[model samples]
Target: MRRDATSSARARIGAALLLLLSGSVVAAGEGDWPAFGRDPSNGHHSPLTTIDRSNVARLRPTWIFQSGVTGYFQAEPVIVEGVMYVSTTGNHVAALDAKTGRVLWTYTHKARTEKIFGPPSNRGVAVSEGLVFEATMDGRVIALDAKTGRLVWDQEAVRPEEGETETASALAATLGDKPVQGSSRLGFKMPPLVAEGLVIVGVTGAGYGLHVEDEKGGLDGGSVVGIEGGYGRRGWLAAYDAKTGAERWRWYVTKEDGWEGVFAETTPDGIPLNRDIAAEKAAAEKNRDAWKVGGGSLWMTPAYDPALGLIFLGTGNPAPQNFGLTRPGDNLYTMSLVALDVRTGQLRWHFQQVPHEQWGYDVASPPFLVEATTPDGQVKAVAQASKTGFIYLHERTTGRLLARSEPLITHKNLFAPPSPEGTVVSPGPLGAISWHPVAYDAVSNRAFAQVRHGAATYTIKTVPASGNRPELRYTETSEAKGEPTFSTLTAIDLASGKAVWSKKAGSRLSGGTLSTAGGLVFSGEEDGHLDAHDAGTGEILWRFQCGAGIGGPPVTYAVDGRQYVAVAAGGASFTKASGFGTGDALVVFALPD
Candidate 1:
């Protein structure tokens, strides 16, 4: 059954109060990871020190839960009142006993017959007001009874427009090819965010479609291809009444007009954008309606600030992925950290990390909120581990640049444009820091990030379309070729804006970082090993080899006074592309009782 409206409101109020009291935005307690990032702050930090550095080596596998279905298991399990909720690759959600990893119940959404873009993956789920909320691959937000896993309410977040299917079918018939996938490749890969009596979620794939991959079957050096006419879709973030799942308000990532804002010559932080302003302005007149399908997908959950009533989230790359000749001008809101009013969904402010992006550099990671001591004394700020290989710190309220840590990885031809031949760029489209969450330690005023050190060759090609418009098409191929890729854990001091310490790992780091008051930082490797590092220094203190790659963030929670660290160990596309095997286990570690 759905939670009562009054009770839900009260719960939200209580959660807000707890956030203010604890100086944390996540409503998590010492024993629970109730939401992604373990709270609204996206701190990914635990207060429990029982499993501190001194005894982390003694940690052993307490239990393992295997979900028979497997494919990119990136779900970060949320534990509420000792019942853990996890979503599998196929949108199968299961409630498990937090203590023993025993399954309590499971709910699976019916599979979609239509082809879907991107990988079959789910990041995680949200728990609030006695309901477990999940965003399905088919564009549905479902509320399940937390205790029994029974269905409560199923809300169609985005319904296909009338004749939309017929339009695609007719287009396919005209071209004598498969039906052209519309912008509504609508689905939710991100974990849901519940706050202010609203279940907040966003849709992805607006900027994705059929891509031509190399013989290796990897996207690293691939080119995106699409139908002749405007093929991309608009991306949106919305809020719904939690109790009844009714629509509240929606914010489209793409602006109707002026999306090509002022044809800025440089980024907000004064980085040369290498744009052709005059050419973009000339092209803008011909492609005046480009904003209709302007792509700006939201890839992760937002970090909420209760006191400020603002929510912060990062946006994906603009539509058409790498082909920028058609869509000219700075793609406002895309590749940005946007702050919105939680109650009204109104844009408060935004800081674009990249302007007029043509490099496929999406700000894919979640933003972490921290209180840093700036030149103006202590102030609340939000930090994002960017794909550009810098930790960007912004003043939360005013959206001011506080500090940006030095590049955490290699920087070669940072924003070189694609050419007919090819241009090599380090920190390729996969990012120096991908979609994984980073950990913030307030005690040490340091942020820990896992980054990749690799590069890709981008080559551009033009093709002719067969549609009525018959417009010339521009496409780019991204081929992986460079030094052997490796991973690193860098500790950035928020105050000094410098790397305090760094540690390298042999394999790529697919998962995220977890810091605790226990003086430890934890991350998962593509090699299937979870390593514990000293929070202050970058020393590997403990390591555990799971059966498969750990592609999700490591979360720490407690049940019955026993501290436990858990992570989803399933293979990811990056792992497979990098020659690492995958697994399908939820491995829990705890100090031996």
Candidate 2:
């Protein structure tokens, strides 16, 4: 359970573990936030500790950089030496002095504006070998000069499948929207994971369905409606040469064979799925070609272990948006934590969280690696935060589940099918940890999650065929009306596998949590406050209002013996109706010298 080490003992253990776990992973320097998740392991814990629990109250804004290009600021800034590289929501890359917030250079990414899936978002960029690389929202990957932000090379990674626009229209019709309002659903939204000289990125929005756009110009608030028919592209994770942008390897999330795999009646953890096995089998035979459009969007940065030569990542929901009767069989690879050969793109092992899932419980969070104690002894483990409200831990080598941390949020009417009248799912599609990364502290044996509180009302609307249209039934899962929403930062004890404490995080949590060696947990709020909590007790130690939704993870680094913390603020592109703020600023904080 818990390896409770303190101070000197903990430091010794953490150092040893870091060295052992550094297989192919970019172990970020103490003063650099070189990679998203702080390092390739996706562990958002910074080793810098200048502004610790003692002086954190004195933390003040040191500088603010405005990118003018505003929207959802989901990209994590990458820093090296004293320079900072940031990819904007519009796929533009800007280089700034990490110390003074001075603009150095800006590289404008020419993104094809049409026929893309979902509204555009460039989650982040990867920097290596003096080059900055980003995966575009329009299905391409490009590399630029790290110092000058000059375009170094550009390569097309993926092209939209033919008839994608028509499919978008058909899916959007359920929500009664304009053609332009239809979601462009196949593109990249995750920061690249550059390791072993290869730039790794994954495709998102491959999971079909018009993710409803609200009046605020965001794809949030409305119900996710699924229509009958096969209209999704296969999702995949690929690796390209960081220098030349040449393709190296590509791994499709859904497998070509054995995808049906006995049509499991329960999840891998033995939770009964209440599956209509017989019906699924019949549908399987009739839809044997469903694998062609099987949606397994990979939208998060994968964690890598150079020692194991394997990279870990979680996959999203299958396409057609959650009506189980459409695509039958176990739908191999989607909604799972999978380990792949970093050099080959071949699947090494997989652990599916929701088999034949209909609840939209995609493994939306990225997996991270940590050293934990098992029955046998100390072992390297990989963990992922699931939309279903648990942090899954598994043995690093075998993919064997070791333990699941306590629930980060409440669950009610789980796995129950949507009734024609409507069924309430406490964690509808917006999971407890909605794509927000969790922060873990090995010394404390705890993990921190920024969780949302709310539920969705799933109503089934069965349509009878009019001429040329077949009878169809689908679930319109919408935000449960009249439900008051809030966010919380919960600390889960890995040793006890229980929630140790939780602090109310504003009206809504805009991003994930970031913990530091300084023993503080930091998270953003929809109300524009970036708060720091005591890592051990979940107490608010300090806070600063960014005045814009802090829509990205908090990152910390050091410059000239001074430690600085930074986060992005922009009103959320989605959820304005929910009261989340928007803007275009990256604020940095530090103690006054």
Candidate 3:
């Protein structure tokens, strides 16, 4: 059918307006978890209340699908239509019938067998327009046909450099040159986000491999000598054409120019940074080009605000992680919540939670968008729970601080510098809130965060350059001490910036949390139990043993009118270090069918 030019133009305009409006609305439905935080805002909240507090206790395991590939299972299952998409360890993705947990199809990638950093794990997948997108641990972004699980396209997002390879080999060589120990140590660990016909994903591990200890010495399970050096790669986030795997734009997390930033003595909110600015300035001239390999890995899926046309995400610590003697200054965007233009990949604004971060306090979790009321009035706001044990709220548009919640966990020797003699620091490295996603309940204007309490011995050793070594080096080590580790689930009232209630746990918390209108908050533990708590008050309402530690985020979706809660039950490195059983299962729960 041929149409008039004027009519076609009007139709196009109308469609554009519809899309703009839809983007502005919080359009997440009760029946689907289409993306990693269940929506663009990363709220991790659902409106379904069918299985409220009164009936939540009646919930039981309705279906359990075993992936049979064990390691750290941390993928949060995403549901679109009636199908649930999950990515397992080794970058294996699967589509399952939401109601029955029947495997529809599976697509396994022949990931690189070479040395890699971190574990063979993925956070989750994104579903949009009949396509499923996954960012693999081996540095590839793949799209799959939504229904059939057929490969649509694959693009390599990060290419390994010779320096990175050498670093990986060096780290592994200490462990008897084991191939598994030396696998390519750089890639993506978080899910990919599909937005405005673009697949947005970031790479991690750029700040890794600086120091690795064998478990034989009570590290690496006392199996291998710790290897430490000034070895790391640059980190970046890139956008790709969703339909065609073509690169659109790329943004390096560490900038070449102006990487030092304004060497402010205090943070944006006026907290004393405790930095030796004079010493940093003196060292800047000699290390002018350090930003090239200065690590600032992106480790979480981003949150998008269509109304603002901005995408928000957090970056990891600077390179050499705990040993930041080479890279000085604020480190610009590292350890910050950065907002960028969705289409152009241009920086809009950033709020650095930790400037010149020495504490391994990377902003590892996803930023959540919410409407917050301030002293002036209600405004668009974004919130992120930090490893430093606070939920920071900011005015989304201007990046102004609205408020910061009270510390949810203990904080000791927070900014203490590493000394030759070990210094004990609480909430060391692993964080009060690790990469686990926090759940927000709009009904109560509260954010639920999983908090961990543990201490580590921080020590520094200076290695003098010798015959083969080219330069002097500093090695920083953080060893976990038996100072009684524990966890807490706390609900902070964002409006008031206060913790309404907190519940303590025996083991450190692993996975994330899901708050529903059912007056319940679902979360998992290092142990193999998934528990439901009363939303208003932190009370354990119900619990289930999934046979493995639930070290991934919990999600909820509806099939027809039935409500189901799902989580990946496989032990993670953290859980295993703390002595927990591991398995590979995606367990789904529901009220009596």
Candidate 4:
């Protein structure tokens, strides 16, 4: 079907099925973890009470589903009604029976095999009315029939118009006789957030590997295009109509014309050529030449708060992985938390944790929204734990910064001066938090978060400019390596930003955290154990050994008035190289009633 006609298909509505169940609403019925982080709040908190603490010891293995693809199965499943929707590698979406873990339907998109792109791993899927939504590793937005898993529409979201922008080069282009510079070129890869009949999404370009051969013969670099709050393609935030796929609006980050590198061939001066970038044109000739693509993708899901009317999304780091200089100016919003208007795509507020990031401090963790009371006795607000290693508290109503808690880790020579307004700190690039969603408990007004404690040493060097590549150079110092360190889960009092309780795990690299009203906290270890902790005091209560290591989030639900806990023991993907266990198993636990 054509992109315009997809909106008129009323049959798609029939595909959305509303299941009515008297017990626990069937959200935790099978292995389907519907919606990212269960619901938009990114809470990863399940109301299903079937498997409570008393009998949780008796919980046993139920079944397993093999994805047949390897990389990272970081996505959680979504269980709507009695049906579960899950995404495996190779852009495959499967519908399974919640009770028996049986595959009901499947759809797969075969990606190109020969390219050197990142491994194919799925974070999760979203469903609405009768359609299921998913994003591919190669940058495509696909809509599938929710009931049958049939293809509805698949559209490539990143396609830059020719001659739209250019990049920089080496040496100088003279206005009669002087040195000059280059400009920027840009594309996409942020998993989208859907709500109120629209899909809100961002883009990830502008780093290395995204260069194109410029008309000038030399190559230039680019910037991100869909970020609404910044520059380069305006860094627009777009809202596409869910039913019709029409663009609603766009918000740009800034309006300054970008720069490009410049170098001359012969003589003392080059041509007085101006790159087409809106500003800083006279000083450079935009290298609109050959450029590579892909890297710094938005690999996690954003959270939504309908009550507060805001969508929370964290962005990835600047391109080329471990180098700076090529990109500058705090790289606004890259390693920041953005609160956007659900209906307008307007930027409500933002907090950039790492300005001009040198390491991979991606703010990509699902923004866990917690509504709790503060210490002064009369303040109620929301909170989030950033991968940058700080627990940020804000007045959710106004996006006001309340406080931040830095992890207790030793640094060799790192120094981040706190802004006059607040303290600046390094949370480690793996993030004090990653894609694994954390857990929140309203009863105690405390949020549980997991993090790694270590140092990643890297350096950059400029290479000689040549071919259709940009003169601007970036290469990480491989001599600097990462030091192994400890890991743990810390419970923070939202009001005072104080660490109330903490339990040390084996290593900094581990799985997500979960909390419950049952007085339990659930999480995994790099050593392959899924343990349950006391929510308030951080005491180890019980643990189960899985067939593989636990690297995904654990959820709890009630079925027929009995409570159960389910975890994905698939191990780590993007972080750990490959020796870790990568089985496609869903381990369900329960207590003896």
CA lDDT of each candidate? 0.78, 0.79, 0.78, 0.53
Structural RMSD, model 4:
12.3
How many clashing pairs does model 2 include?
A: 17
lDDT (Cα, 0-100) at 446 in candidate 4: 74
**TM-score pick, better of 1 and 4:** 1
Per-prediction tally of clashes: 5, 17, 18, 80
| Preferred candidate (lDDT higher): 1 or 4 | 1
Could you tell me the lDDT of residue 270 within candidate 2?
A: 83
Off by over 4 Å in 1: 1-27, 112-114, 160-184, 221-229, 464-471, 574-576
Q: How does model 4 score by TM-score?
A: 0.73
Stretches of candidate 4 off by over 4 Å are 1-34, 112-117, 159-192, 204-237, 250-297, 320-322, 372-380, 406-408, 415-427, 464-472, 475-484, 507-511, 575-578, 591-593
Write the residue-wise lDDT of candidate 2 on 1-593 in tens digits.
12322453454345335433542333345587777887767878876667778889999999998888776787788888889998887888899999999999998777765666655566788877788888988888999988788788888777655326454454445445532343425788899887777889998877756656556554567667765557677889999987678899999987888787778888888878888989988788788877777888887899888778899999988866667777888888889899999888999899999888777787878888888788788889998888888888899888999998767777878777777888887787877877888887876778889887788887878766656756667677777877756778899887668899988865677678899878899998877889989888888899999978877888888889899999988764465465655788989998998
CA RMSD, predictions in order: 5.8, 3.1, 6.5, 12.3
lDDT by residue (533-560, candidate 4, tens digit) is 8777888778877756675667654444
Q: Total backbone clashes of model 3?
A: 18
- TM-score, per-candidate, Cα-based: 0.91, 0.94, 0.91, 0.73
Q: Identify the runs in model 3 with alpha carbons over 4 angstroms from their true place.
A: 1-29, 160-184, 210-230, 470-472, 480-482, 574-576
Model 1 poorest 10 in a row by lDDT: 162-171
Alpha carbon lDDT at 114, candidate 3: 55
